[model samples]
Target: MPTKDHYAAITTTLLVWGLSGALFGALFVGLYQVSWSLGLPGWQTLLVATMIAAMTTSAFYSAMPVALVGTMAGVLASISYLIAFGLKAELITIAGVAGVAGVAAGSLYAWMVTRGSRPLAEILNGLIAGLLAGGLLVLAFALTGWQVNMFVLAAVAVACVGTLFQLSDGWLVDRVAHWLPAMLSAPVVAGVIAAVVGASIWFIGGTTTALLDDRMTAALEEILSSIPSGLLGGFVGGALSGLLLEFLGFRLEAGR
Candidate 1:
């Protein structure tokens, strides 16, 4: 039977992650619009946007370590974006790059949230989680192209990497306790959960975008329409996943 705490976790995760996704979608599209309108370089715009999001992560938790960790995460993410633009990479390539960057950012997030405790363990586990999360994103991009939007994928991937890294010692330890230590188990669990959640969101958002595109007038318009599609998918998928994860005994720690 579901307890009151379970219901609360479900409600909270749904609202928080859903809003987070919508915000990410808006920021992503908004940056593109700014780049187009101002004739600004895409790399420059991406850098600015990534920095803002990175800093916002620490700020969101009101953590004291925001300065160092946020700056590092922002720089890492921005560099990936710059590289992607320079290479004129396809969506799959971009997704892979985003996963690598997400791992670094997530590690930083864990460090901050835990107030610098267990540095080596957190980073190593985060790396393993990254491989899983990154591969999943690559697969998702290959399947859906731009229908789901990169922002939503990256947001969920990065956030999960951090949260899952934190959880490696809890339930995951039991599942892999026979073969692996707590640190190793964290990544496996985190990666799997992230993949499932990310893929589900991709399917939902991509499907919605496809349906919407069928009624649209032009290529550019159809592309632009994905923003709302991402928003809807993020909310619905986030809510559903939150419920499932909570029921399965997954929990996120509040910012310290």
Candidate 2:
């Protein structure tokens, strides 16, 4: 059976992520809106939204580390948006400053979460996770000419995977971790996650966007395309992180 904590975390993630996404969409609806929203850049908005969600899931334990995960994910999402939409110089600067902050924050969080193990390994793992996922988001946007909305889907993917890892004191993650060689488990998990997110984005809004973004609206085609991107990106991310994690001894402790 799942613990109370698992139930709480899932609920928190569901609400926080969902609300944050909605808020972001509403807040950034127009050029004037973006300027009006306290003059903060879109990425900062994402960071704040993610931070709010992370606080809920990470509050009791791993709170700080979880914050790092959210911050990095948001910053990278912003960078991918820039690339996908054709870079605006302002956004590039935003990406750079946020990237540095993300690195510092990620390093601290990795050290906190991984104990005495090399913090760089977990930090790198998170970075690669962002990169692989971001690449897929960029590719999909470039090909289809969709807006930068896939980050919401990516957030769901990360949340589901992260929540799964926290279950039964990491029992679920450990079961999978042990079943596959540490070397291999990372990519499998990553691919599954990316595929799920890709498929999810397709089902959730790709269909609708088809009618919108200039009849560039081939729902079936785009959904089909996302599958491979998910798989390929997942494999790359999984392999790199898996190997590094194994090297860093980043095993989860299960139920007592």
Candidate 3:
């Protein structure tokens, strides 16, 4: 049976990540709005905001320097892609490039965070996690076509990627006995957790009114409209991630 300490840790993780998600979600909307106002493409703005929010959320969760570097790397890659391809790039092309960039960002973050220990396994975990995270971000953007709330979409994606990124570090990367194949298995587990949490956030955010448009044409007044969605989605995702991690045999380190 789980102890009170476990429950407390779960509660803590949920609160911390939820607040973090809300904070980052707001930042995402602001950044996206600014970029959109400057006439950037919807996909381009989404990439910029998503990468920044995801990296910042990662840093908040892990309290690591690699998150800073990861943020820079991801942002630069997004900007570079925009400069090279312009607005004419197809969604499939964007997805492929984003996947590649995510792999690089994840590998770099894993290498730096682990300091070259079990490099292959850690890098593998990063690659898989990053790819999925990147692809899902685009999916979230696409969901906007179906009228999904942008704030919820961003919160769900960022919260999912951020939690999984650090969870793998603690559960698999930090352990020596976890082999290459076993390490590679982390993404499958993380993906399932993310899917559940993402869906919950979607439901929570979807039922409400979307204040701001996620696209470049949204008016300035709508920028702050998604704050509520961000907060709620972040809280739900963080709480569920904590509960799931605890059940999976990982200790939730408070304030870390």
For candidate 2, lDDT tens digit of each residue in 150-220?
33443333433233223322332233334333332222222222222222333333333423444334533
Best by lDDT: 3
Estimate TM-scores for all models.
0.36, 0.27, 0.50
Cα TM-score of candidate 1: 0.36
For model 1, the superposed segments whose C-alpha errors exceed 4 Å read: 1-6, 24-132, 140-228, 252-256
TM-score top scorer: 3
lDDT of 1: 0.42
Per-residue lDDT of 1-256 in model 1, one digit per residue for the tens?
8689866766675677556545434433433443444466544544443333322321332222423343344345445554545434333443344444445554545544543323223334444544454455446556776543554543554444334434563434334434434332222222222222222233323423434334432433544555575455435544555455555666642332
Assess each prediction's global lDDT (C-alpha) against the native.
0.42, 0.35, 0.52
Report backbone clashes per prediction: 0, 2, 0
The reply for model 2, stretches above 4 Å from the true place, is: 1-114, 148-256
Between prediction 1 and prediction 2, the one with superior lDDT is 1
Cα RMSD for candidates in order? 13.1, 15.9, 11.7
Alpha-carbon deviation at 19 in model 1, angstroms: 2.6
Error of 2 at 186 (Å): 23
Model 2 weakest 10-residue run by lDDT = 25-34
lDDT of 3 by residue, 146-235 (tens): 445765665566556655666677566567434444432322222222222222232223322243245522444455565566656656
